[model samples]
Target: MDINLSLRHLRAFVAVADCGGYSAASRQVNLAQSALSRTIKEIEDELAVSLFDRTTRRVSLTAAGEQLLLNAREAIASFDGAFLRFQHYREGLSGTVSLAALSSVASILLPPVIFEFQSLRPNVRVSLEDGFAGEVVDSVMQGRVDFGITSLPRKKGRLICEKIAADTLTCICSSRHRFASKRSIEWRDIEGEDFVSFALSSSIFEVVEQGLRSADVSLGNITKARDIGTVAGLVSSDLGISVVPSLVLPMMQFCEYRGMPLSNPVVERNIYLIYDPETPMPPASTFLMDLLRRGPRSKFKIPNGVRWIDYPDGSCQANSN
Candidate 1:
């Protein structure tokens, strides 16, 4: 049998059954006695059973009504509980936020922020995916993640990119290298030096290449490495020096290397928060994005060579140097 009934119908039935008479039930449910009688009649007719034995002064439930009462109460309670949980999710009290970021960012910049976010919304789970800049962008575009953090320059019009921070490129070399004695090294200082270049596919490679080209300097490319650890290993072995964003220095700390600030038309790699403006994020995701947009420098101690960008009125502006 097709049981086409609404919650209102069940509520009316329950109210009538609980109150024991139409006059009282009508008062409790805020309906006229006539309307309450009609609602009870509709339920009885649909089920093809006498749900209540009508008396002059009171009504008593039949066996079928007794059975339905149990099930109806359970169904309503279940629905109410589910709705309460949904409300919590909507309020950002509980839900999952998935995010992607560059490996350097995931390791260095995000830990303290994630810790603070979890403290505020303990029930909200944060899932972080670490990858290259291109992978981070792809995750946001494909809806694989709620948002992404990357140093890759904005190339996609579909994405709404906001610059969150900038890290200066630094010349990384062995501690024993002559460049380490200097406070900072100009781009021309590394000209004709044996250089360990990042692989062509690396996002850092493109930035370094552009910066070098802009400064009118060239290096004798000795080797190409894809992994930061590999580059560190090569440089520590006195193979050659390489230029990377200052944020990358911490990862190479175990190796004996010094990061000297690179100048002569200083190149700053801009970090961006990227998301598809068309997609609606979950409450937890939106909350995390807001925390990030507030600028990490306000909440945590950032590295020396990195600067947070000011995001006011949805426009990108550099923070005071």
Candidate 2:
């Protein structure tokens, strides 16, 4: 026999069995008595088994009906439970959000936001991956993560980059350095100074280099480090000074250093939230994205030398060029 059953058939059969008659089952199922009878008959025909014993006073389930009743109830419960879980996911009450960000952003910018998000939706899990700017972009592009937070990408390609915050480059040096006494130092002031430079792979390096180029100033490159901690360690050792985004200052708090806001061509590093427009973000991911887009001015505290950029409609694309 070719058996094909719809939920309607199973539900009608269960109602008839539970209510013990067509008249009462019709009321429970909101179907006319005649229609309810046809639905039960349809199930029986499909399964090639008589499911009910009809009596003038009462209708009772047969052996086949009794066995199916157990499975049918379990099936309906499982289906409904699945839908309820999906509802929770759609409402951002539960599910996981995977995010990738630059090391500085992951450490300095995301902690409070993640805390607030978890407080609001405790069941929602947030997984964060911290890496260099290029790795952050790659995670978003390869679909390994839901979104990325980083400085503007050199080649944005298909990524939709939205500027979320801006941090001015600050010159960091040992506390005992001569520039520590100055309120603020210009780019030219660091000329001929021993500089601990970031590796070429670092986005900060590019911004600082461009800023130096714009100011027509040069520094004696003492060392190149790939990690921010290494850079901080080197600068703290008084080997040389370094120019880093102000957002990174928080990470260097353990090291003894004085950060002077760089001027004479203030270079601002624009941080962006990037994602592939082709992929649809989940509700949890969308919720977190909205929180980040609101920036520090809304509810989060803005760090020194860093300012939030508010987009008129809550978002705007970066100028990839």
Candidate 3:
């Protein structure tokens, strides 16, 4: 018997078997009734065996037909499953996306994006690493990850950087502290006070120190912490007050800590999405990047004492309220 059977032949045979007759199978296969019958005849001829017992009153499967029916269904299903997987791959819905992100962005901002992304592409695997801003940048530069979420890269080099959010630096203090009741304070207000801030290696601390320098306000007594979580704990314990990004408020250990807007030299750190333009991203990574770009700033609930400082381009404003 000739094994030269096509998918159309297998499909027509399955259609007739399931539909119980050629007339009904024609409609199911979207082929003419006569064409459908001819397809089944060709498949039977290829196998050199009868596949169905047909009569004027009814059509049913014979012993040979029953065996072929099972094999045919299994073959069609396997082909379709492979085709669907390939289609998903071509559409960029079934690959892995690797990302490196700063600790703050990873904890505060990425969970919603990751949740929504997983719901959309359940087959695509997502991997993320949380590190300092410098580490995140290095991962992108070294091709260790697909892209990174961190403070804007200090030097563009070969990377493309786009701002995702502008997080303002605010003073955090124990509720009982003198500055907590104030609506806003300036760099000068915290001068001469004990300061708990980012470690000297932190990019944010560099920004804060530069801002303080421009304002000519100095804190002689200072302690440094590596992450926002530790900085918040220090403020909560009254060990020392600290300045941190507004996103840290949601993760603070103590509800009694107050966030006060710092002015005179308002410091806003722009969070950026950085990728190597020379390296093409996987389809899954591109899809997730689009989702992150389209996320509305209003979705991030701005806590009290934090105001939306509008930029001239309106890109930094979170919401009107």
Best by TM-score: 2
Q: For each candidate, C-alpha RMSD in Å? A: 4.0, 2.3, 5.6
**Which candidate tops lDDT?**
2
Q: Candidate 2 — which residues are off by over 4 angstroms?
A: 312-321
Candidate 1's residue-wise lDDT over 130-175, tens digit each?
9888889889889999999987544565787778888899998898
The alpha-carbon deviation from the true structure for residue 319 of candidate 2, after best TM-score superposition, in angstroms, is: 8.2
lDDT of 3 at 299: 57
For residues 1-321, write the lDDT of model 2, one tens digit per residue. 456988788889889999999999999999999999889888888888899899999988899999999989988888889999999999999999999999988988888889888998999999999998999988998999999999888877789888888899999999889988988999999989999999999989999989999999878856999988899999999999999999999988888998888998899998898998889898999998888877755677758888888854435665465
Residue 281 lDDT in candidate 3: 89
Q: How far out, in Å, is residue 280 in model 1?
A: 3.8
Overall lDDT per candidate, in order of appearance: 0.86, 0.89, 0.80
Sort by lDDT, best first.
Answer: 2, 1, 3
Pairing residues by index, what is the TM-score of model 3? Answer: 0.74
Better of 1 and 3 by TM-score: 1
Clashing pairs in 2: none
Ranking by TM-score: 2, 1, 3
Pairs in clash, predicted candidate 3: none
Global Cα lDDT for candidate 3: 0.80
The list of candidate 3 runs beyond 4 A from truth reads 1-4, 20-24, 32-38, 45-48, 53-60, 82-98, 112-128, 138-146, 155-157, 174-182, 235-240, 255-258, 276-288, 297-300, 304-321
Give the C-alpha miss distance for residue 74 in model 1, angstroms. 1.7
